[model samples]
Target chain A: MSAQDTVLVVGAGPAGLSAAATIASMGKKAVIVEKEDVLGGAPIISGYAKLVPSGEWAKDAIGRMVSRVEGDGNVSIHKSTKVTQVAGEAGNFTATLSNGDKLDAGAIVLGTGFTHFDSINKPEWGFGTYEDVLTTTQMEQMVGTGQIRCPSDGRVPERVAILLCVGSRDRQIGREWCSKICCTVSTNLAMEIKEISPSTDVFIYYMDIRTFGLYEDKFYWKSQEEYKTKFVKARIAEVTKSPDGRLLVKGEDTLVKRPIVIPMDLVVHAIGMDPNALNPEIAKTFGIGLEKHGFIDRAEQYTNSQGTTRKGIYVCGSATGPETIDDSIAQGQAAGSRAVADLYGQQKVAS
Target chain B: MAIHEKTLIDPDRILQHDHLVVDGVDVSGSWNTMITPRTLTDYEEHFEEIIQSYSGGENVHRCWQCGSCTNSCTMYAQNVDFNPRYWIYLIRLGLKAELMKDKDIIWQCVSCNKCTNICPKDVRPEGVMKATAHWLEDNGLTPKTLSTHFDEEFTHQCIEFGRIEDTEVMVGFFKRSGQPLVQAWIVEFGKRLTKRLPLGQLAKMGMNVVFRPKTKSWGKTGEVLAEYVKAQKEAAHHG
Candidate 1:
């Protein structure tokens, strides 16, 4: 393929890998620029345990995608590097990489995914104050290692409380969008915890269980019925250490119409997704726009689902919003096809 | 005046000290009063299943605790404590002790089916209320309510005669509950009935009450109903 046939794909997570694979299948070259040393973005880099909907371990699932793109001859990988600057229009653009490499590309596809909400932001939940309090990422790491124990003493916790929507849907925190996937992920985690330690009781506290569509029976109901995981309809108010050393979760049991303080051995924040940290910089570099939530803004969703505010510049996955892994991958392919279509269309115009 | 509802805090949880000191500072008086931190741990894991064993309670497990039941309940308009949603939550979580707190008022459900009609989960919370009331009585946590007594009396009348004798039911219920039958309201109702009725219809009604009339077509139906009820009661108790 000619140099102008090359596509610059940013972020080598599930979406980036799929985008690169799609570009390669179209007989075009794809230069994947990943900021991290690893390929499979958050799932592999953040050390996620098991993915939702599919019980496949994160390493195994994302690993397969990484290997597929890695084996393709038309795809070139760039690790620990970023696109520093972009110049010229969509049809003929020059991208300057952080490593002093310049690349010519006809189009750009951003698959930069989201960052996990830090539990430290919500100190009232006792994430930073208490040792047993952990974020979903840390809890996923614990589950990954097959040792679900208190971080402070390494003791097996008898009761664990997972608080959902830690960073999302709270106007106080200025994050009003629902983080879509946490409900199903929390339910899946509850089941996994029960499988590893049958004696431990898992309680998920949430304002709403948004395990939408088919996930209702698969995760939410199954967790209750088979695993005996309890789901409480309450947004936890505060988490404090009890006089007896266990963490006390204070909340109004909305259904019971009573304020309850339950002692738990461990408390987990089922954290939400935030816009990628590099979003503003990426928007500036690519000369695109950032949406209100600081995600990459879309140009027109109806005509071009993957189109960014700038022509021939596509955005997909969690970079646009809180997106699931499977949806992100699908969006990645759409973006790749959009880039290919635009590049061919430009070529025809030139001819 | 607005109705005074019971506070969620148990009286035992409130602690007051005549004299108090903290951090070498005498923060007496109002500062001395404290509410002890209370945590619930005595959850019966199979409480939901137990409730489901009763007739009309088979779908208790399906409730997502949406509060629609409580929001639309007829009795809730009168007393907020009469919450079917709250009871369903307690049952789902197996918080038997938490559920016991509302035992006195659970039988107050008016069987309006408003909650059941409005529920999006098809939880049939009206049935859950009935089942919970029955469960409360069956477990001996609560005494048989007046409504339960009346229901039993009405059912007995229906099965024995293959029809209902309203006067017999009222007398049977009053006798079972040890209430005086010659109440002011009953006397007034009898006077109204006497004033409004034709002589022949009035005589027929008086004869039915005196003779305790039975339907001629009611052969094995009464025995079958009684046997079915006995079998259902046994199943509920065992389950």
Candidate 2:
């Protein structure tokens, strides 16, 4: 296919890169635009530490995926560029790049991912005031350094508290939607923490530990049984600093209706995800709709996870909704196949 | 009184409390969490403005008493009862009495704009605070300590001189509020005591405050302000 028939993909994260790779393998040109100076989004920042299904290292799998996508010659990667304006009808869109360059494409796929809810938004959590209180993203960065030490004293924490549902399932704050990935991600991090520092005590405060689908057994069992991570079915009401420099967590044991106060050396806020700020910008530019939660709105849930109301405008990965890397890759391939089918049908009609 | 069927609930037999209460009836219990359904009639006049100000105020009615806003607010970092979300919920249900009950908190908003900024929907929480404050002031339910002092000071000064005299206003506020005069004029007193006052003529300052120049149109301006207030009250009634 000629370069003019190329598919424009925004974002070079897991989903965008996967879609580009899939399109290139099908002998179609894929032009990928990434706002970041380098490819790989959150995953590259603090490399994945997930438990692979094959019991292998997660870094290996991510490395392989990155190499495969980068090796493709049919894909033209443009870094530090974004689609500022998107106009024209489906099957023919003219996207104006931020650099005054324009690109014509028959189809476009959006894989712009999500951003972590700023922990400072919930200041009562004592995120900035207390050195021991850190968000999950900050914890990930510390883990990336291969050592977890209290920033205040540079000592391993004797008791670590992980508070869940920081921004999820909160109706009073108006964030009623549950950020699906927090449970599994927190559980994984808890387990890793325990394995690294066996002597350290880990307590997870949650309204309910939601481990859905195939992830249920591994996350719930491994964290609770194997690692012996204490699970408290309660919502943390307050986080304060103790006079002795320890972090104090207060919550109610809902079953007994009694308040529980626990002191810890460190507190980790398992903060949830929020829709990217650019979701609305994308919706307005492409004439696509957004759901009430600010994610790109699909025509329907079952049949149109990646399909938008406008033709030739598709969305995958967290741009559509909260999703995992595996799910994002699957959605990318699906969107790629859908674009190819549309192109092939048009060619047949023209011939 | 019930002698027809001879229905007996024996002391030795286990008695069920469910039998005492019937369907759709209020049961006497220690927990009075059952919320009374309130009518929006009292606020029906300003309902359109309130709704428009709060972006329809329909979404706020969906609050399930989750107390997320209370738990999430930074202002609550200092005061727990100062809940922005709860006030919005109360407004949605048109619980004007409850809205008036928390008059102090209605105005305590620091305007950090975080609550609305973090709202999942564009609820515009700051607007809710403004609406609640307006509702309270309209009903004359302002807090005694805070609002009364402010209103008394403003009205007294305005009536005495037809406009506010800043220095006199400060002195009157301190005297009426029963605060120490020393505390009120601590800085001014210190400047005078230290002999570090400005190198300007004291006569100019005295003329500016005590012998302040009067406007030729002062009477007309006062008449115009009174007319404006009257028009506002009439429009509010018609609305």
Candidate 3:
């Protein structure tokens, strides 16, 4: 495929990889420009133990999509390259790579996904201060390493408390939007921890379980009934350390209207999704708009959920907002088809 | 007129005209319901400290007013006015006057331990209720309610004998609380008790009241406990 037939894809996460595959399948070249050397994004960087909801090993699940994109010769992998500058119109554009390589494409897909909320912003959570305090990503890394050890003593935790909405849905921190994936991911992690160490009691403190639709039965129900992952309906106020060096999860049991302080060997903060720090630069590069909360603003969320305010530029997956892996992949494909249609306005097929 | 919804305003303080005009303003709409401006001059700056001085109210300072306590409260289920969360909020803010409005129902906490078990901040609202009721009595905002009298009578007997004869406690509590000792329920219970108990057991009960059962080595323990309690109570009220 010539440079004229290629589509520029920024970010090599699930969204970018899926978009590359979809574009490649349409007989159009996909040039994936990733800042990182590796392609699989968080799942690979954090070495996620398994994809939540499905329980598939991160390598196997994301690897399949990665392989599909890599298998196609139409996909060009630009490793450790960043799109420093972009210019031109819908059907004819040039993106200058960090390596001084210029790539010309018909359209651009800004699937530059999201950054995990830096739990350090919430000092009350003790995320970085205490050794026992771990973010959901850190916890997943520990689980992936085949040893869920406490950061304090390097011993397997006897009990763990997973707190939901650490950054999301908290007005104090100014993130009122619910990070759509944390609840299901937290519940899933609770169950996984239970499975890994049955003796390790897992407690998930949540205000509301947002395991909506299909995940209601698969993740939430199974975590509760089958795995016995204890769900406490309370948003934790703060995490303190016990005299014995264990983490103390202070929260009210909303159901019983009483304060509960649970001592835990490990406290996992299911930190919500935050827009990537590179969002402002990327938005400026594409001449697109940013949402109130800083995600790439879509032209019309109800009608065109993935279309950016800029004509040929689009965003998908967590770059727009927190989304599941499946939703990211599907939206990637949608962006691919939309780009294909936009690039070839008068024609239906690649021909 | 832009209306300010004063949810916390005193109903009696609100001056609403029935069929008259206010200085030719003809406030005929719902705007006619005018709330009297309030100047809160009764905030006890250290009131939360006093609440925390009580055993159950020790964690009251940790409360963020999530309303979980009120939602889970057994009393709140029956009477919505029985709100532990609201009282905790008032106490934290030192709105002593606002807190006093719910003084009558504060003592109705059933000591269910539900509030204690579920408090995320471990406010132990059940204990806060007990402490608050005591605080009210200590401050003389209200007289010693029946529940306080019963508690005092029970504690006084326990301290004196180190053990309470069941009948003695009942008769003592009833007497202290100023309830008729010959109530219909008590009469029925006594009749049933006599019917169920053999003569020997009944005699044992009579002997217990006469001799007054005592913990064998509880001589100085009760005295020490009573003295410590009195000191703590003094400190709680004055310190």
User: Between prediction 1 and prediction 2, which has the larger DockQ?
Assistant: 1
Interface RMSD of structure candidate 3 (Å): 16.0
Give one digit per residue, the lDDT tens place, for model 3 in A243-311: 878777776666545455667788999989999888999888788899899988887666565789887
User: A46-118, model 2: which lDDT tens digit per residue?
Assistant: 4556532333345566666667877888888888998999877666778899999888887888888887777
Q: Which stretches of candidate 2 lie over 4 Å from their true place?
A: A1-4, A46-48, A51-59, A301-305, A346-351, B1-239
Off by over 4 Å in 1: A346-351, B1-58, B71-80, B94-98, B109-127, B144-234
Each prediction's DockQ against the real complex: 0.23, 0.01, 0.02
lDDT of each residue in A1-351, candidate 1, tens digit only: 454789999999999899999999999999999998989999998899999888899999999999999899999999999899999887788999999999999999999999888888899999889999998888899899997888888888899999999999998998999999999999999998998988898989988889988899998988876787888888999999988889999988776666788889999999999999878888889999998998889976777789888887998899999999999999999999989887787422211
Ranking by DockQ: 1, 3, 2
Model 1 quality (TM-score): 0.77
Q: At residue A314, what lDDT does model 3 achieve?
A: 74
As a whole number from 0 to 100, the lDDT of residue B148 in candidate 1 is 78
Candidate whose DockQ is highest: 1
For the predicted complex of model 1, DockQ is 0.23
lDDT scores in order = 0.87, 0.70, 0.81
Between prediction 2 and prediction 3, the one with superior DockQ is 3
Ten contiguous residues minimizing lDDT sum, candidate 3 chain A: A342-351
Q: What is candidate 2's lDDT per residue for B83-178, written digit by digit as tens?
A: 776665455434455555567766787777776666654555665665556555656677457556766787655644467766666677777778
